[model samples]
Target: MPQEKPDLRNLAEPVRFKRALTLLLMTLVLPGSAQIAAGSKRAGRWAWRVIFGIVAIIVFLVLLSLVWRSGTINLLVSPKTLRLVQILLILLAIGWAALFVDAYRLGRPLTLERNHRLTASIVDGVLVVLVMSVLIYGSTIVSAQRDFVASVFGNGQKSKADKGRYNVLLLGGDSGADRIGTRPDSITMASVDAETGRTVLIGLPRNMAKIPFPAGTEMAKQFPHGFEWKNCGHDCYLNGVYTWAMGHKQFFPGVKEPGLLATSQAVEGITGMKVNYYVLIDIAGFQHLLDAVGGITVDVGKKVPIGGIGGPIKGYIQPGRNQHLDGYHAMWFARSRAGASDYERMTRQKCVMTAMLNQLSPQKVLTKFQAIASASKEVVQTNIPAGELGTFTDLALDSKKLPVSSFSPVPPLIHTGDPDFALVRTKVAEAISKSEALDKAASDGNGKKSNTPSKAPTKPATSGKPTGSPSKPSTDVDDVASICKA
Candidate 1:
């Protein structure tokens, strides 16, 4: 018998169109292609499927526009509706998990079973609509809430800046109800390079000393009466810790709030950068804020399948790689010290942030939109100015192609000292040298790196304790001390 001719509909497209369509799916994964990939057995399977797929995708786009706003604002979803949606998402996730495994193992266009036109047409069509809706709506909620939550939690008091690179001192504190001692968790100097639109984060281990800030004479100037700002027995350096350059007297009649000037001044002097802003959040505040923003998105990676205690995750977000983290999990990820040390914990914190950024991608945010917006309630705090926020949005969106850079604690050159203030001074001096170099390069317009990139970064002479968030803040000289002592 002669070979049978292929159906016109099932026949593949011309070389160029096929190649273009395939390329588009590789990155875009449009709903139509997804539905077409479902089943087979039709006479004009390819043509008919693609046609229907386009129509379905249009539906997906329209649905996305309708629910986009719901993701950003704190919409009141009826509990019943919310539960139903959650259940549907769960079911979709299961289906996605199956498809995901197959796609990974077999690769695309690799057939899994005999094509079934009728079944594939119906199921694929429904699934495409359902999945697309979740993706678009979910992500929109998460991203919008992530940025705005900072303003809400800070109580209308966020960081401020102008057209140039803006700097902020990010501080983490260990204050908690169960804490043995209250101290800074970690300090990082962070800066946003407006020109390059890149973010730079630096970690300052609290253990390092000889920092600068509490000007040696600050004691005499601000707290001539003592460190007690509102009360005679209050912590002397407490107030100064939150606002850069503020002065205070010694507390405990003689005991100091560590060294006041050494750490702060050293940081300012070394980085050659100004101490424009600072803020301190207690452990409770950090944890509470995270809970408020519905929690951040975290990706589970081979890096950490088994947690600090070798605990099994009952669907603890699978270990391979994923995003969307809640406060509870993120807290442990950043704070877990079981098998990891303070340094390792900082790295984990950075990972959490990176995962958040990945999930915030335009395509992903649309799915988790509602949860993201609701969570933004108490999770973040910053000092970036309102005017700069619009600019920042543009910069962040463009950051995809921008080269991201980060540095580690400098070594041997700096160390913690007996008098806390003395060690702070040393750190400040080291940072100043760096800041000055960058400033000069920026002035000359010969620098490809940001105006705030660390001039130099090396492991500290010794392993020290972490005192702030994993990474440093933008434009902060006192970050090292802030993270360590917060």
Candidate 2:
């Protein structure tokens, strides 16, 4: 009451609130998962506070912007997404705090600045985050992707009978050429059972020979008068088959050719499931997907050299041991081979893919939801409708143990003229057979089996498994190429 000259803080109020709001928004919107819990705790830390704060804040802001659409709110997310959102938020808060410190240093009176600076910064950050969270979660309430497969897949309702087991085709592509005839480097089929919550991932090497497409004999036919039969590694390259047959007809998503259709048909015939869901993630798309997932943790089984492959992947990298990698590095790990054998590459691909999946969960992806979704759209072409996709996710949410197992089928069971190709084809077919039977068994048991099947089965912890070269040791087999400098 000593008649303090009418505290002219009104004009400053918006400025104060502005700073706070900006910080808050940055905090919530950021994509780092750490931001959610340690937000307050991180604020109390000492060394390199500015770095942590800014990094977190920037991450949160990016994530927040990603979550909330321009005009929509879609915050009702599962746990993993939520956790990711929170982590991102914390990162944003730290970022905001750093900026706040800078603002205070450039400005005036210590008492006022100190009194309001931190509070203003964090509150503002939280408010912005809250608003963004709501928007991001709300917009996708009826995600379009959910619609494409909804009619057939059901809305996470219905009895076990409706859920059924599934055979999903996962294609990893290196479209060095146009999308038209680019072959898939890696092919994986996943068998998932909702009731049992079991999942198995099997790998198909690129050079597999003697692949029988679902089109019966029709799949092997050449395109035109002078066009070569689509025979690539075996009688025909898988990619060529797609362009030759499916591209013109447009039967599947990103199916540019009948290759996918034929492959699907073959798998369906083998598994007896409609082969309901197909996800084609090209190399670029796969890279983006891994990037969106914030990189993955993988293990290097042995000393490996890279950059020897004839294409863009020619270089030698000696990874020290089990390590972590971001999107680009992971891609390299999946595709590199200075001294790696083909079988080694197969193992590496599976390891990288599994590591990528392990990184996603409801609680971990909330903040980065939009980026993930965007990345998914660009990188992946899936046949499962959006609604069905949601159901699949929801089912994943419910169960822990899925019924499945995976292994390459390309063992050199028999010697052949084209040794490597023969082994690859054999393994791919064998893997497909195993996956199909396991998934069918799960589906059949959904109604007849336990009311609640656990989550998908976990691949045994082979984090330290070696990436070994495979050559047919059969009496009649021949090595394709001499071992590279390992």
Candidate 3:
């Protein structure tokens, strides 16, 4: 028996090299082809079937999107689907790894020359790594989405549009361990047309006092005329609504998010728009999110402070056009109020949002998906129903082509301290009308040029100075796409 031990060196030169090369090339072109060439043809046929099925499904989805965009997006973003996707990816990783091992087995590397066996092992190792890496990354995105969807949205019914519009209240809070409660420093209402997705941003000041609440809400009943903390003297600012409401949580009864609910009521009263949902984002935590998308590009109008609040001045963002900003600098770009008015800060924030929306292309999202998903989970908290997420996603994609116009109820237009509710409503209505009219005009223009697709939205010019008039400090409305154009 010992004498019968054979050596691969006995194989003919042609048989050794040709057979190994054929197997390696087969697997490279078709993952299971090596098995068909040497092992069970049935197994290889099944692998081919799976591969074809995956491609077919992807093609079907692409076609579905053209016909029923919202339905496709909804199905894609659904948390349940994401969970199933995670499971499928894990299974795929295992299955593909097995096919690779089987391909190497069919190569009969053990019976080849030492150099040929070494080459086979290296190729197999590389294939395994590439396959596993992609699967793991895909799994990470699904997991992140699952956790985020569970944490942020409820399993509530989809909300209906109000008068052909969906209004969402966006609140930015700068809370730290040292802080007693959250103070919503920035409040903005996004009124989006139900069909066209055209949006009008209404910025509200944090220092606004006597904010009116809805007629029958808890806060309305408590403050009757408006949100006034006369007992706390002059500290009853609009931003303090959350902190004040948190102290009186008993009044909210069974409300899960008492602070957010209270602020939504105040925002509804102030904007004269019924908010269907609210998103409370932590300003400090937003930096990580910016970094995840490889930072956002912004047209820095002025030299903005980096880190000056509750600490020494760190640095400044120099004025520039199309400046690429990281997490730390972008946070300051949106928030820094040092040597700048709050109105100016809001304008910068709006520009930042617009820049992010424009620059965050689909390719970038796919490549940095894991980081974006992880960062989003930490910063954003919302009451938007999970079922409606797909609809909003589709709307956002459609809205990208349309211009975004902004209106801030500041200074000469309407005093924040004693804002005229009637006048504010009128201005908001007019802004909405103007935005719709512009969209209609753009559509008509595009139709006239039927042979060509619509061009990118134009941006407004940028000046380092405040967006408002220097002499009178009046509210200014402009296209954000133009304002943040690179």
Candidate 4:
């Protein structure tokens, strides 16, 4: 009984194959375990220490995130932290692959039968590829995220929430070879409560004239009365402010983006709300984003024309329920004004936006993250700092569950040619107050609607033309859901 000392390096064929597979499994489960069992204890100990440290750090971060979400998110998104993560992942891939190789060596693969050797080799190769590929892919995603954060968000001074709310100007820029310069075709300020994420979207018609700039801004000093050009008749509009400011860069010395600054100031003056940040989206590139999420499903209320602003109409998004639109059609759905008034087009744009927000699930986002990230870089440019991304992202998630109210200074409510700035501000305040009251009522378990009525216009204006104003004055809609119906 004492004479039989079994050799691990030269075992029976079946036993040898079994041993080899066991070793590989051990390495797969916990890198270096196989090495410690059969090979060098020193290398295995080092590997184990590294793996344990990584796990401990990850656990600590998870716990920290539970208590300090924004800080953890900011730290993760930081350039240095991302770089460190990228390098660590690469190192882990290489090291873990090495461990698998070492485990194979410890299995004495050469001594096994030819068939057993082949089988062990295939299993070892698969485990290495499986482990290494995931780690490498993770590193790549992290790198992409770092690059995205750097390129999309500015390193601007952080803005605090103004009066328990953050007012962000969303500009849809329309720039083409046919135009002189980029003009903001869509101008909406999304005012969100800092706590509850209650939102009020204040839309200003691109054709709205007589836009005043904030008091201290240079634009205000230049145009003491309001935004106006000497002889630029209908061309001097709200959207043209961007192009105008770009042309007059001398007025905003030391400012990097004078156009955006001018526009934000104009929004502040119009809304009587502080402009905390601005996200300018290129309208043409917006299709890419819609395509990334596998397109969106919206209830198309009317036949939205594809292209007819300066060219012939290409096609139409026919009226339908639960209509699934690709990027191209969705872009046209949001931007088209052909055979439709500006206010009608604005309503359609809000519908598209709402549909996107409601339908874009977290699972879909994760699955299509790479495409979304790439498209977002192309579509969006924002003054919101990288540090505040986590906070705003949280708010956006909260906003999806809440009702979104919208107000536009269009038609009978306020004339685009000669807008009453005072009336516009009052409407803006009323919209915000209504949104807050709704949020409060929801929190208090009161589903009853606000009974307050808006101040109606004494003389409702009417227009005979298709592109002209509607007969009824525009009023604030408490919830966009009712308006965006199929």
Model number with the top TM-score: 4
| Model 3, C-alpha of 251: deviation from truth (Å) | 0.7
RMSD per prediction, one decimal? 14.6, 12.8, 5.0, 6.3
Could you give candidate 3's per-residue lDDT for residues 1-486 as a string of tens digits? 367534546878558767776776676568678778777799889888888988898999999999988898778778888888899899888878888888777667777778878887888888888888989888987888788777777786677999878998888898988788888888888888777777778888888888998898888888887877674356677888888888888988888778898898888888788999888889999999989888876656667787676777789988866577888888888888787788877777777776666667778887887787778878998888888887887777766656677788888778878889888888888888777666555565345311112332354322221221111122555566555432
lDDT of 4 at 274: 96
Q: Taking the tens digit of each residue's C-alpha lDDT, what string does model 1 give over 130-237?
A: 666665455444345444544443323444443355555656655545543445565655555555455555555554432333344443344443334353233323
Model 3 stretches astray by more than 4 angstroms: 1-12, 231-233, 307-311, 442-474, 482-486
227: Cα error in model 4, Å: 1.5
Each model's lDDT: 0.42, 0.48, 0.76, 0.81
Q: Write the per-residue lDDT of candidate 4 for residues 1-486, one digit (tens) a residue.
A: 577646865556788889889999999999989988988999999999998999999999899988876778888888789999999999999999999999998888888889989989999999999999999999988888889888898788899999889999999999889998889998888898887776777878888887888888888887777887663345678898888889889878898789899999888888899999999999999999999988877767778888997899999988777688889988998899898888887777776766776678778887787788899999999989998987887777677666567788887878888988899899888888877766556553365333222222221111110111121224575466556655
True-vs-predicted CA distance for residue 19, candidate 2, Å: 25
Q: Where does candidate 3 clash, by residue pair? A: 459-481, 459-482, 460-482, 460-483
Estimate TM-scores for all models: 0.43, 0.54, 0.88, 0.90
lDDT-based ranking: 4, 3, 2, 1
lDDT over C-alpha atoms for residue 86 of model 1: 51
**55: Cα error in model 3, Å:** 2.1
Model 3: how far is 117 from its true place, Å? 2.6
CA deviation > 4 Å runs, candidate 4: 1-6, 229-234, 442-474
